[model samples]
Target chain A: MTRDSSSTLPAPPALFDTAVVAGVGLIGGSVALGLRQRLLARRVIGLDASPEVLREALALGVVDEIQTAPGEWLRAADLVVLAAPMRALAPLARDLAPFLNPHALVTDVGSVKGGIAAEMERLGVRSFVAGHPMAGSERGGVTHARAALLENAVWVLTPTDHTPLTALSRARTLVESLGGAPVVMPPDAHDALVATISHLPYLASLAMTHMVARDERLSLLAAGGFRDLTRVASGDPRMSRDMVVENKGALREALARFRRQLERLEADLDEPDELLAAALEGKRTRDSLPIVKRSLLPQRHDLVVAVPDRPNQLGAVTQTLGAHGVNIKDIEVLAIREDGGAVRLGLESPEDVQRAAGILAAEGFEVRGRS
Target chain B: MTRDSSSTLPAPPALFDTAVVAGVGLIGGSVALGLRQRLLARRVIGLDASPEVLREALALGVVDEIQTAPGEWLRAADLVVLAAPMRALAPLARDLAPFLNPHALVTDVGSVKGGIAAEMERLGVRSFVAGHPMAGSERGGVTHARAALLENAVWVLTPTDHTPLTALSRARTLVESLGGAPVVMPPDAHDALVATISHLPYLASLAMTHMVARDERLSLLAAGGFRDLTRVASGDPRMSRDMVVENKGALREALARFRRQLERLEADLDEPDELLAAALEGKRTRDSLPIVKRSLLPQRHDLVVAVPDRPNQLGAVTQTLGAHGVNIKDIEVLAIREDGGAVRLGLESPEDVQRAAGILAAEGFEVRGRS
Candidate 1:
């Protein structure tokens, strides 16, 4: 919980020392704002292709200065962050290579690492370290930037065998300064892992969204369930398109594996009696997941008690616990009516159960243990 | 906004009036609760396999009485609702065939309808209507029941040509009483639509969750994007298994289309130029959706004006807007530093933009158009 400030790392030259943020939109603008808030930089400079966006960024104060030329800006910046589209990594690296400061540590905020690393190699930006701040919202652009967006989020750094230890340490320190947890890994491993977790999911959401879109009636009938499932598909298409295309091999592998799961479930559906036993087994297996994996913690604890079957009985029980300074961590009304019912109460500690039971019994209610 | 009291129908005779709820769990329990709360039922009787569940249901006042014996319950009730597992629909119908009240209308809350409809026909329940209330949370079980869970949700009803007009009208009334909007369609069409909109999304979520589960380290690194995308995968395993199994055909088609999309994107990824162009196109398409779809209104009409980079700029802008009695819907600092920055002001209407801009200009702050 405590900040590590003993690294003896030199303070950023100025509170806002000419931060050159390439592709100044959501992530970049937020980084610029965060640096200013923490006094990490004295001035935030921005680079972008769209003049409208540049004007928007400048008007929004996302950057103190806007540079039309990347090379010129890179030469002047102490720290350069590439926050552009994933596919532009190669050209962007090439543009920065010739003008990069000798002491400057260039990094990126791209989702995929292997591709960025390959691009950097092609661009001859040997000093660059690949970094991705695992933070974002569905909404994009500088207008959506928030200073504390990166706080407590994991910032992953993927470095090659040839990457310098000093540069790696610098990147880690920068991530930590922003209140982010830094995780280090190799480029290929990062790409493969992200393919499974990030890239494939985006494609899956898109596929599902597109499927619904095909049936106009179904699309209109879509409720929160549909909305929640397809929310990711509504993200920046360019980002999604790049992610799916860049990590195709890994994504294809993941999709194939996923299809197998569906096929297995489909087989069970065709024969219910035979599958019924297996289905029950599957249910038990699902139920025993926490037991099988000792590392996993139960979402809530278990407790048993009795309450009236009257309206708002669950509410009343919770209210009573709240009043007595006893928190009913989680409650499961086993049964209810105007007469009586059993309810399971999840508590933070076993000791609280005794007090809670007593409190309810005093209110003319019956109480019992779960078993 | 007002309830139409004149349209309220009188209750049927007690002997001929009974609410039948199959598989009395969360959704079923909530339906029973709603029936009682709105006085839509003369008597509420529940059918469940587990005696403990039946006891709990009665004790909680979720039902007027419990019928542990399925045959007896199905025969006595005037309205029968199927809320059991999707896999159980066929067998349950078969079991209730000989006992069903001659004039009783059967309906269900199964996520998929085509599979259930086939089972219903086999069981000789020609009057059955399949339905899905597109409202539910990650949580399940009777304990989580809420009377208002169906409010404002879309309740879809699928009926065949043989469906009686009286039965359909009755079902509509029940759905409307629960504060739900009813959408009717054919069984096959319902299944196909849900495959795209509902079942497909769940499978997508499950696949995403599974993908993350494969990589322990990457799973730990998952942030909001990963969490949001996979939220539906955390639903009850039994229910999910049944849904996937029952809706296999349509889900398979959905998965196939999704795979094709991934393949195309993968091909494009090999060519960086094409990939970048695609990404840009996606970005443009997503960005323009709010404008293109005039019906999908933006959350805020208030403009966010980027203030020039300067200290106290936000304070000065807020004070000026406050003086004009133009309440600030929301305020965001797009970027800030020692030199200057922009502040976005959310107004109540587009008309308020002019007044706010004039006020900020007079206060010596550079104001811009709404984002």
Candidate 2:
């Protein structure tokens, strides 16, 4: 049955019976494993250009079976997941079009969705869904793949004007079933937002890492400051390079915009009214993100407890909170002295906090904060 | 009595009878607190241009007394820590020189050392040791200051050719007493190295933070990626602005060098063979910093223990290690799954690991690792 383009509401289809996951790396392998674990697909078939990775995925139980090409698996698939690198997505979509099952709904896990969605359409691929899971690790491969990596992650979907409604419904349903929050946006908007959030951070990380690496003394004595700032530099280099190139225009513009800001700050260094506000504003912007994190829970109310420099202090507090059905929104054990540390707990809400504190204090914990 | 300069080893005289801490902010208040907490001084006096902050410092018990200006306190001081911002250092030193006792040893906590050293020389502020402690927090003020803030942190000291040996000796002794490890370098060398390590990271953080802040939508929706990379942006903007301005030349050069590298990466994005190598090299450089952290411990050894996804796991681990006389070098409790987490412990030595693991394993913890 062909998806109707004129209809706004999607007709929910049956669960995918057979799914083929192309590339079978971290993202693809996770999708394959998740489909099986979530029981969304009866058979999750894996395909990869690399034979070694195929063997690894099969041995790791990420897939029930393996296929070398589209002919071996695509015809039987009711849902096809494109989990290849950005450069490989178009060619893989081209390969699947000839063999894809008539009822199949196709989706991808590529970072950039605008070019990829257009590329799929140009190749005459139908029932396409463009999605990007905002989750990954520095260590990429089937071995690092987890069934729950995408759980609670924001899965972004970019649908163009030419997109099919039924396919969108299937994609949203699949993403929700897999425990990911699906966010819908236009292709260009998704590209722009992610370039600010994801791509630019990588570029900044690379620039700082490059700065440290080029200096002999700094390279030799790269310490905590350097380490904390460059954690994203550990991301797979070729993959990062591919991301930058695929979205070259947007990223180049981002880099230029950032450079101009840096130059402005440098110019304002001597008379720093402008620079001070910019730095403080940057901080204020960063502090706002955690509030969003807290809002995902019921609400947020933090309490700090002074704990002795002993074992199980954290465990005792957590155990007390857990017994009362209070979940910790966030936590940090900051050492305030050579002998003592404070355990700061961000509770679900102000109401949850009073009970949580009551439980802990009754159990002989030095709890601080009313709400 | 004059300090003997010809002796290869310092006599290590009575630590200090009185210490004056200028600024009464995070670094200065911490210095005041640490002096008293370490019992290195009989009286720790705080001086700040801002009486509001000085009062807060006094109320927090960071210092025994407070001074609005150096006039009331400088002549009586045996040791003085110039912990003011970069711009305030030279003038503060000049102000103190008039009322300074020839016996008083002077030092500072400025990030950039060369310019401050030259200015101190220009002001005839001898008996000066330029020092920068590579430790601080995003939260600043007397209220957040702790006696242990500088404990076990690297304190970079810049002792130019014009520096007095007595001042160098006093600085080293003070650093060691404050639980800091001192590393000496020439003023110019200190400036160049810190420009790449400290100043450039601040710039990179600023650029990324500014780019995101400038975008209304992006700023409101900054998630985990932006939060992690731009943490330094939350630092006191005035302090950072002062840092950039004072070390403008070296920092400008570092920024230019980093800009050149970004241009190279942008140019090679399409055929990124060379750029890929640079990114990978960046990762390698970032990874090596932890080894420096490990070396600071008595005798390095680490073990990872698996714990259930409930609270008190960390407290239990810390308690067990503390009971076994095993000091934890570093601790990170990583939640890999929804049901359970892993407690990675860096213990004092390999000898301590066996016993710590035995205790933890006996308590139903799954232990992993070689050292």
Candidate 3:
């Protein structure tokens, strides 16, 4: 019934007098915008090797102040986000080390955490919390950055053994202030987990794409499933290469595990039960994963309704839900037919899903989905 | 400026007096609807073992007549489309052979083709044209059936050496009339291609999902890329199992090819250039895949515009396109930022893309994308 684009997360108490976001690319620019929009810091500064990027950030109001490079200006900051490319993170942190105030809690938005945390420690940035916001776009750079990119994103904060409690708390507080879910874990654990969930998946997609490339005609036959399976392969090659290389140990282990699974599947081709079990297991696990909505806030519960493919069917379904006082967080036309169609409605809560399903079913709509 | 959802392809002349579609499931129902809507046949007779399905098809107006099973009614059909389960195709063809008119051209909509083609050959259905329509939905059954499902779809027709030229020509004509792009290939070739592009990718997704399911926390950390990579894993297990099992030989070869690619990636992890080269290759191939639009009609050309994240930015872009006499075929909000956002506009032709890009750039908008 309502389309609220505004933030619903509670305003946070101002945590910093100043925050410096280095690099001013997608991640850094987004961090600056989030700090400014959420009022997490009084003054936000942008630092980048490129003056043009800094000027763009300043003109866009992503940062209140701009710096061509890290300098004494960092002393005024309570927070510093190192969001340069993977290769540049250590050097940027090392350059800012002497200028940073003792109380300043530094963090980063790197895909790999253990290497960066160790690098930061070597650079004497003691107040460092390695962070990875599990959010991105195929498009990169500040021009494609937005404060909303962090909204309800699972921001993993990997704290090393030597990391100060105050630094970790401050980093978590900043992540929370930006409307990101702060998930705290050890650096090695974060790297290992991401290797399975993120890095290995990217490699698999790339490998699959490569396999398809062997036969020029294979791409012509690839349907929507193949496109979706290999979507991540189109991401920046240098960046993907850096992540995979940095986490190669964990990635190799994950690849071996995946290979074993394929072997099992290939061996059990004759026995439909094993294949069916694996598919069912996959479906169950994938269904259980939280559906990331536009805002990525309070999870949305979805239900599919089989409606007659006539005029105003969608209007009627929405109206029926509206009458029941159920707000549809998201809706999509999954398939269209002249005689019948399937529409998926995303509700805010499980209770709302139950209520809407019961009401719709009574109204002669066949509804089914994971609530 | 114009939004025409109507078929642009030439209207098909009535090629069949009566077309019989066996098993009114999603594929069968869609085929029947396509035949009727496209005026490819004067009448469509639906046949299924279940009277309930037959009744539903008749009630839905997807067929002119309904039959519980193949019998004397099949003698009137000039075209027969076996759109049943993969396992049921051969037996259904065998059962229908006794009643089918000698002039009737037979075809199927199975994912795998070689085995089915050979089985049809053994059944004395020498007129069979094995087909695999690369169009499907995660949702199945007649409820989600649509005539548009075949529109612009790559419908592969694998005609065996013994297949009659009349049958092959009729099959291709029917496919074209349904707004499908018919691709003719050998049965073994079709199976091999789909195994690499469809079946193997499905297994890879399934394997990745299984690997991720090993860690309960991994899913929590998964972002959009992971979800998309594993999306096909949630498809119908029974159907997916049948597909993989039926095409086991080609699938096993595809699996081995994929493993070799992954092994190469693992070996080259330490070599950034090699890894980067693979990623670049994958990116190039993935990017080259055609964008599938809602209508799935004539191919649409795309361009990305970096618009300022201000109110009415999208409205202004559309208005600009409209003023320039360019119609947007498909539009998507790729990313949003307070200062900038990436909007991808799909135009009807490459010329339209060039003109629109130049016009937008002249109007102070930054546009970049594949043409």
Candidate 4:
């Protein structure tokens, strides 16, 4: 130690000695895995009503220990995450409150925050922070859970007047450790924000779809743009109903705002310049969206390869690149024609594009750089 | 000398001995290419005001001959396609009517049908048949044209009082020969149908984008669902404005219907059952859409494969299948996690699924048949 100055540095302890997760589903299981993988907790415990789910979590190594219900073991927990269904959250929070350690930082992963936040505040749980992780899948279960589910996800944290400042800080730190960006807001504010961002858009999509469906000719003529506009209309009805109904008040306000916006657009039809300006503004905003920017990964260049529109043509192109050790960072079918279609392959570097283009050309595929 | 039965049978003549496609852009160039490739015409001619475009069209073999303007050679045409812009269609029809063969079937490929249909009727063009091929791309020009662009597309033929029955029948036959499904309707009816299907949905998407863009917090929180609902808003503003303004009357009616639908939905928020029913109806209709049905290619089975979230994983998987001669009909990223993600691969048959599963499994990939 005396010979090397760097060796004198002290090793930091784990962020938490023990962490507990309720509801061993996608969100819950993912948090358990994240805690372990990030070395943020010395031991992770899973608490689920289903013993079978607990066993699966243990087998998957998502948790070091399992509990069928709340007990004295919870007193050893320094952190607790409630990942149960919205309806189950209240009862579960009440049951665990007595056993939670005084210093435990409690949090949740629920989609809606207003009702749950009020319930948690009434329950008087230990240093609770209501959170919503803006990430999900059509599929669910512990089997589908992944540690990286939280990575780069916007984890909204709604801390009430009841929550201690230190608890909020701790929750933010944990979210950051799990590779999530923590956005703090009041519960009501969170509901209103999501109403505008998610709920209203869903309603608009559903309305457009149903309107077209009413007439056979309109439905028959619907093309790719219409398809894209209504894609979210096909999500699970029950889930959508629950989310929207829970935040109906804020959603109603958002809907009124949307209607006014639509009326203004209808009027702008007479003023071509105004209409074009609005459309241009929308295009600019859409292009600059975080999702699109993220998908356009840095250092990537696109090569559009023309392949005969036959079975396995896309596979053949990807196979050719893989064989040549050229990585396709992203791939998309740009245009589909029965005789041939264009496939845009995103490569990491210009060198990859050159190599891929040459290899594809030699394989009798026409290739061009994306314009 | 005795001849084979097949050779003795009379050969059918081409659909048109000479076909002229004006305004060599995506639709025009594609039509010219289709005419040549399908042998529907013995000689395909390209006409454009731009000599550069005419030369490019000729060089690309999209057309057998090129002309910078309407000439006396138009008299030799059996068919004339007015693929010019909305404002130029009337002038082009009038200019070509003087030199057209008496029997030449003059058709057009304009998205907005009513205005052009009225113009053609007034101009008294020979055998006018206003057509709109419900197929297009964001990218245009002779270079991007493909014969198969019209394959399996629904080409709406808006025949008017001035359109002769023989011309309509001939147009339908030609469309069929080019691998398009012929849909017959009046031009105004076509405008009304597209107003509901295309124009209204676009306005809704643009309105939603503008609403969200007004709030920075909402923009920050906008996710995949919002992105899907507003995708059409990012299209070329000039084109969108032109289409919507040209069909403003019909679009206004469609927008009014949409507003009523939205109001009904807003009222249904309190009645969860009603909300759920509406959502379910939307889902049912969306699932039954032609686009989704077409994408669910026949005899194809999906297999979900676990892949570490890294560059070229998709390529590697597709390459693996291609190397083994197992064709992938479709592939999509089902879920993305930072550490890993799940990809859904559609194989041609159950046998291909079995083979792909085994091959991917042997390569250390965790594979499972889609539930």
Most lDDT-accurate candidate: 3
**Model 1 spans with C-alpha error above 4 angstroms:** A1-19, A41-66, A70-76, A248-371, B1-16, B70-76, B264-371
Please give, for residues A1-371, the per-residue lDDT of candidate 2 as tens digits: 12222423211122567898988999999988888765567688998888899999989889988888778457889899999988788888888788887678889999988888888788766688899887787678899999667766778888788778878888887886665778888888878777777777787778777777666567644566667777777777778878877777777777778788788877876667777787787777666665332233233355667666556657867876887789988885533344555665877767777888787766666665531
Q: Which residue pairs does candidate 2 place in steric collision?
A: A311-B315, A311-B318, A311-B319, A312-B315, A312-B316, A313-B315, A314-B312, A315-B312
Greater-TM-score candidate between 1 and 2: 2
Which candidate, 2 or 4, has the higher lDDT? Answer: 4
Q: Give the CAPRI class of candidate 1.
A: incorrect
Residue A81 displacement (Å), model 4: 1.3
- Write model 3 residue lDDT over B180-292, tens digit each, in one string: 77899999999999898889888888887887788887877664778878888888888888889999999998888888998999999988898999999999998887666
Higher-ranked by DockQ: 2 or 3: 3
Q: In model 4, what lDDT does residue B16 have?
A: 80
Ranking by TM-score: 3, 4, 2, 1
Candidate 2 vs candidate 3: which has greater TM-score? 3
Q: Over the stretch B102-142, how does candidate 4's per-residue lDDT look in tens digits?
A: 88988999888998888767776748889998888778778
Q: Chain B alone: TM-score in each candidate?
A: 0.68, 0.73, 0.76, 0.75
* Candidate maximizing TM-score: 3
All models, DockQ values? 0.14, 0.33, 0.44, 0.38
Q: lDDT tens digits, residues A1-371, model 4?
A: 01122222222245787999999999999999988875668799999999999999999999999999899989999999999976577789889888888899999998889888787677777488899988887678899999767766788999987789999999997886665778899999999988888888889888888887788667776767787777778887887888898889999998988888889999999999999999999898876676631232243366767666557878888887887899888886654544555666878977878888888777767676532
DockQ of 2: 0.33
Error of 1 at A286 (Å): 11
lDDT of 1 by residue, B1-371 (tens): 12222432222222126888878888899888776654456788888898898888888888888876576656668888877777677777777778888688788888888877777776777777788887776677787877767765678898878777878877876676565668899987777777766666666565455445555565565555556665555666667767767777887776677667656556665776775564554433333333211123333444444444434546766776787898888775543444444444667876788788777655544454432
Q: Where does candidate 2 stray beyond 4 Å?
A: A1-14, A49-61, A290-371, B1-13, B49-66, B219-221, B291-371
Give the fraction of native contacts in model 3.
0.80
Worst 10 residues of 2 chain B by lDDT: B3-12
